[model samples]
Each structure stands twice: as structure tokens, then as C-alpha cells.
Target: MPAFLESERLVLRPVTASDLDDLVALDADPEVMRYLNGGRPTTRESVRRRVLPRLLHEYPCLGTPGFWAAEPRGGGTFLGWFELRPLDDDSPAEVELGYRLNRASWNRGYATEGARALLRKAFTELGVERVTANTMAVNARSRRVLEKAGLLFVRSFTEEWPDRIDGSEHGDVEYALSRGEWLRRHGG
Candidate 1:
């Protein structure tokens, strides 16, 4: 089993066909999808026909890695998923960082640990110039994780969602780190 990247606590690997059940369960959790889809459960048909295909196919396209299945390096428990993929594949330097974790895996610094590892890979190995992440403005927990992972508060903005989540009125916040900024804090 090949891993795309490894942190001290996590082994980040691409989602395979074998990951459907895990992905479905993760998305079905209300807390996990609170900010994403307002806790609306994704139908099994949707997961099978839509979500899994995109996740499965992206590994070949993202090259270095796309979305990853984040599992503990210790006992190999499935924690959740993390992503560091280009917004536009034609320009691979501007990547985005995002994560979704199991409720059981919450508050354990797993998110921060995984995020920092991806940032290190982005700046040092992948030559990414900038990485950005966004979350609902009221998602203080995720905001904190992004900051802890070295992404600074960039701005707050709004997106017109077709079906807005509960906290959308507060808008969304973006956090970011540049290669130079990352090196300044963590050393090159």
C-alpha cells in the first residue's frame, strides 16, 4: 500500500474503490457535514455514482496527490480526509487545503498535524507558491486548526450557495500561507 504523504501521526493516501463505505459514513455524520451540506445525508446512490468516482479519479490527475484518506500511523484508524489540490490544474502552484474528519477523531490535533505536513510538502517538495483554505465564518474550531497549521487569516467573503447552510449569513473566511511566509515561520 503506497502512501502519498506521511506525517508524524497520519498516513495520507488516496481514496480507493475500497473507501466507499468509509466515505459514505463520514459524510452521513451530521456534525461532519454541518458546514458542508447542512447535515443533509448524501444518498448511497449519490456516493456511488458521483462522489466516489471523482475522488477515485483525482488521484491520477493531481499527480503529487489530491484528496487523501487520513489515518493514524499508530493503529491505522480512519480519521478522515485531507486535500491539497490545485484550483486550476493548468497552474499547479496555487493549491487549496481542506479537511473533513470523523467526529470520533475530533479535538485530537489530528487536523492540525495533517495540515502542517501538507504545507511542508507544498512549500518544500511540491513548490507550491500559495495554499488557501476557507470555512464557514462561524466554524471556530476549523478556523483555529487552520491558524495552528500556519495559515493566517486572509479575509472574510460571501458565496451565494444554492442551498445555504445554517451559518452562511456570517459569511465565509479564508486563511492562507505563501511559500515565503511558511519558510519564515518554519524555516526552509
Candidate 2:
């Protein structure tokens, strides 16, 4: 079956070949890429040749896994993307959550909405034991989203960035929540 999940205001569908244009446009926005690649826009060639292939190859063999192209419900606008998958191929029980939204969608609770929905699914139906998210130390926006999604502050660590962006000097922070924690938070 095709991969998909729906929230009240978002429909997260698998990233497919046809989503190439939307992916490119999302990456082209410097505002959206500010935290990811230092505001550098991804070339269309890269999307066509590399990125799309990687996303297409990752459509979970079973459940709706990997990255999803998130759009507003009952619409065609590409708000952004969200991911809820393992840190690596071998770590099935430990998942990581992440999102990248267009500037237009910012401050509208779309990010938190998608994240909460993903977390609920992970703990309830996806066999996920732990969920983690990391972002630049100075990224208050993303930090807030993670917190609102019920992930607690885990730790801060420094890592070398190949292309070290403007805020890379401050290191990164990780936030996480386990299945037990989720259950307790939701009174399950």
C-alpha cells in the first residue's frame, strides 16, 4: 500500500518522483534552508539526480516510514516535509523526528501538529521505543516545536560541520521522549 498519514490540517504523503518540483521549491527558499544549509539553495540538478532518488528509495517496505512531504489538508500547497525514522537502518526502536516548513507555514502550529501526530503514532502503533530530535543551539523556533511535541531536553553536544554555518559555533541540542514517557504524559 502507498505510504500516507493524515492529521487534522496536514496530509503527509510519501515523497515521490512527481514531488520533485515541490522539493526543489522548498529547498530553493533561503529562509527555509537557513538552519539546514546556511541559506544555500539546493540546485535542481541535485534534486533530480540525487535527493529524489534517495527519498524514493526510502519509502518504508512495510509501514509508512521515512520522510514525508507534508501539505495542508485538502490542498496542493507544499508546506514542507517531516521525518520520523530510525537514526540508522539497524535501530528500529529508536526513531528521530524532524521537520522543515516553508516561511508561509511558520508560526501557524503546523509543525507542532504534524510532530504530535507522528509521535502519537510512533508510541502507539509503530513500535518506537524512543524519539529524538536535534537542532542548532540557537534555533529557538525548532527547539520550541520539539518541546511542544512533548520531547524533553536531553543534552547538548558539539559536532563538526563540514560547511559550518553562521550559528554552528553554538553546538547542537538533543531532545527526546521514550514510549514510557509518552504513555505517562498521555495517561495511558
Candidate 3:
């Protein structure tokens, strides 16, 4: 499949039905799902019914799927996925940035690389006015990746989570960058 985006060591392509196994494996890892679902393994049925459909749907505002399967540059294992989805179905002004990689791919800079690339695309090619991301406050590693991708801390807020997980008491932190800010920073 042709890549939707590329970085030095990774390629992001539109997610497909063939990626079901990879998604299942990525979501099954306890370490990977620690913050997401308190280490609860997502059943393959859930991946098929809920996750894959969301991943496959092309946002009307963006004219493309918001999620992409991540893989190594020259064809390798599925690393995980990256997302740059519009906040609203009809607007591309604001979008959320996200990534999930298998345990084997963590701490290897793939997340940061993919994130930076997405931010660039959001600001330059996609007509996005703002890019935002958030994670549990306890996820220092994820916060660091957002910072390294050039987003600044916005605010910390708490919401009702159906199933509370570790660090839920600490709330969540939002990070964001505007297109104007990005242009100024990149001299675009």
C-alpha cells in the first residue's frame, strides 16, 4: 500500500482489514494498554467490530482515513498506528494527534517521528488550524513525545471515565499547537 506519510524510519498507511491481526496484537499487550484500559486485553471481536471500523472510516472533512497503520520504512512488522482526526465531522480546523505502538516499538523514537510528521502535515498540507493531544498526567513518556513534536502544554482537566485506571485521579493533560505557531517555528 502507498504510504499516507513517511518519516526517517517509518511509514504510515491507511488502515485496512488486513491489519486486524496487528491491531489485535497491539491492543492485547498489557503494557501497551496499561494507560488505555488498565491493561485489559481488547478482544479480537472488539477489534473487528469497533476498532477496525473506526480506523477504516474516511472522515468527510479530511477526505481520508484519520488513522493509519505504522510500519518500518522498508516493509517490516506492524509497529502500531497513528491518528490525526478532525474533532468534528465537518470541520478540519482542529484535530487530535495520537499514536499507539507495540511494546517492542516503544522508546525507539518511532512515536516522536510519526507525530512530528503528522503535525507538519496537519499544519502545512491539511489546512488544520490547531492540533491537540492529551493523555493521563502520569504518562510522562507520552507527554514527552508530544512536547518533542512541538506541542505545548495547554491545560490539565478531569473527566468522568467509565472505568477508572491507574493515575485517573491525577487527571489528564492537554497539549496543543496552532498552525500559525507551527509556521513561525518552522519558518514556513
The better-scoring model by lDDT among 1 and 2 is: 1
Worst 10 residues of 1 by lDDT: 56-65
lDDT of 2 by residue, 1-188 (tens): 24378999999888878888888998899988998889999999998998777666552422455788888887878888898877666655888899988889999999999999999988888788999999999999999999999999999999988898988899999999999999998998
- lDDT (Cα atoms) of all candidates against the true structure: 0.87, 0.86, 0.94
Models 1 onward score TM values of 0.94, 0.93, 0.98
Q: Candidate 2 or 3, higher TM-score?
A: 3
Candidate 1 vs candidate 3: the lDDT winner is 3
* Clash count of each predicted structure: 0, 0, 0
Q: Pick the candidate with the highest TM-score.
A: 3
lDDT of 3 by residue, 7-125 (tens): 89999999999999999999999999998989999999999999999999898999999999999999868999999999997999999999999999999999999999999989989
Rank list by lDDT: 3, 1, 2
Clashing pairs in 3: none
Candidate 2 segments exceeding 4 Å error: 1-3, 59-62
True-vs-predicted CA distance for residue 75, candidate 2, Å? 1.3
Of the candidates shown, which would achieve the greatest lDDT relative to the real structure? Answer: 3
On the 0 to 100 scale, the lDDT of residue 106 in model 2 is 96
